[model samples]
Target: MLGAGLLAAAGLPATRAAAATPASTSVLISGSLASYSTFESKWNYLYPWGDSHNGSALMVASSSNHNHVSLSGGVLTLTSTPYVGDGFNYHSGTVYAKQQVLVDSSWPSWEVSGDFQAPSAKGTWPAFWLTGVNSWPPESDILEFKGSATNWSNTYKNTSGAWSNTLTPISDPGAWHTYRAVLKKSGSSNVQIQYFIDGVLKGTHTGAGFVGQPMWLIIDYQMEGSSGSPGPTTTTYFRARNLYLARSSS
Candidate 1:
């Protein structure tokens, strides 16, 4: 996931401010839903060549030859393998929901929930996050595991040119855990975000100037960032299952 600081470093536009107001009463949309079993038809592999990163790993589109990403047994696997190409020494996986699977004005209130086994390798960075389809600084990172040192998940929200983050410690990152994020437009251009882990609320953040904008989901296993240089020399993997998305009915 791109942190607020990293977003700024990438020359993305700053977040805009919106007036604070009462929260919106949003409910899950009855039929706007998806899961791993239906993922392929609803998602697309993100070609990873023009993105910012300090890692040596390059993301590749899903293909028979590469097999960087795969879906089977109701689970999705994103693997990072050692490869020598484009002067880089590794290859990993990244995928995003199809453009049609966007949270826009028609469905501003939304939720993404899933079970994941976070990779614990020293130099791995895995995240389940959301970003604006047509803008920046409106990102919401539901779960981000930086490495073994940070054996926990961090949730981040960028709004009003600022970032709000909360760290929830986990004893074993390799163990499967439930992660979820619920977002609702609370005002004309503001959203209220709530993060949950294993059904327990971990954090809440409100983002300004982000309401009613189209946002897309991203799940990736990046090799390195602030985690350090020289990522795992061997293969590493991130796995997720029971992934789901839904929109508000009201």
Candidate 2:
């Protein structure tokens, strides 16, 4: 487990889960605009915004002409071209399953697991994250960008003032891979958060500040370039599939 580092740019609901509690659930936010749960834009800032802010993340949808997100065979595929904004440029897309549609009905008490095809290149940052209905950064980020190269790895932020860590995967992220985060309800004795890579336990957290509250799932493409990372020289894209969200039986 890696310690929470200095900074980097930043950046669910109930129901579906209640009606159908699959031992595992696949979360794919794509295709027709109606397929997505509505998301209200929160923070639009760049990053490291003054002393660890809250209830805000940087995510935007594609313009009509640029929009290219879809759900095929239960997989959420996201793609887009470069766009100028916030003193920087980005060419990625994002969709949220928020509002009436949610992953869980409470807070500090949710787990998201799935396989993701990590983005290849320095500029690409893809993630599976969640946020509070009222606060921003406070939401947990289960998985994040796994850079392309030696020693490249993924990271997580338990924004609830819980715990955060960086993880190194055994396999290359260029190909499809599985990742999971189990957020157990905080108890008077033991509160824990577990992370797994490709079905292997990688890390765990305690005092995660995770309680019972509803949260929604969100997936998106992120770029680190202030100007869109040279604009994807060769058709780069992001894919997240076979996702599952289950409330702990305990």
Candidate 3:
């Protein structure tokens, strides 16, 4: 049940980084937030690595392969099926935006929000997050389900590895919920990042040296690592919809 707050505007062209896709541009996002949902399409399958991201599941890259990635109605599902024998034991899905957001001083105050219905079953990890394109740190974990009833909001400050985490427990883990992040620059160097669940503010954190970093937005289903071991033997699912990124002048 998406609301009026699900921001959507015209889709635009964007460049890709190292992926096999086309290319991307660092456009100053202004006005109402627009949707640049493409490396070429709405989603790009897998990380540039094609599979596995510090997790037990192997990412399935083929868009035609519904066993790992499927789209029905408006929801995109990333599945993790164990014993698939696809070289990595468990097969899953990962997708990234073709668009990149520059986290510099000039970037307009932007917001990224999406509706996700993820598995809370142990060993099934799903994340809606952003990471640096050429480096690490300056990461904003919009919504992370570490195989629990708790939603973890995290922001990595810098390369030296300082981060702040806020855990919000879900009363109904299977129900659809909205998660969002709003970022505003604090001074000449850092940005104040705020976390939200169901339109309510959860916590606010500061990112160090975030002004110069550019990041790629990603959503993937990982198994076992932070979610613990001995995962579900049956197939697991992670679904997302009504995703948008908006910018404002302030």
Question: Of the candidates shown, which would achieve the greatest lDDT relative to the real structure?
Answer: 3
Candidate 1 stretches with Cα past 4 Å from truth are 1-38, 47-54, 99-108, 149-160
**Each prediction's number of clashing residue pairs:** 1, 29, 5
* lDDT at position 215, candidate 2: 49
In candidate 2, what residue range of length 10 has the lowest lDDT sum? 6-15
Compose the digit string of candidate 1's lDDT tens values, residues 79-98: 88888768766788888766
lDDT of 2 by residue, 1-250 (tens): 2222312111012212123444544333223232333212311212222211221113443323234455556566666445555554544556555331233333324556667876756666667766555444335556666345322222223435544665564456767778777766555423466677777777775533334334456665666632124545444677877656555344
TM-scores for all candidates? Answer: 0.77, 0.61, 0.80
Q: Worst lDDT window (10 residues) for model 3?
A: 27-36
Better-scoring candidate (TM-score), 1 or 3? 3
Q: After superposition, how far is residue 244 of candidate 2 from its true place, in Å?
A: 1.7
As for TM-score, the candidate ahead, 1 or 2, is 1
107: Cα error in model 2, Å: 9.4
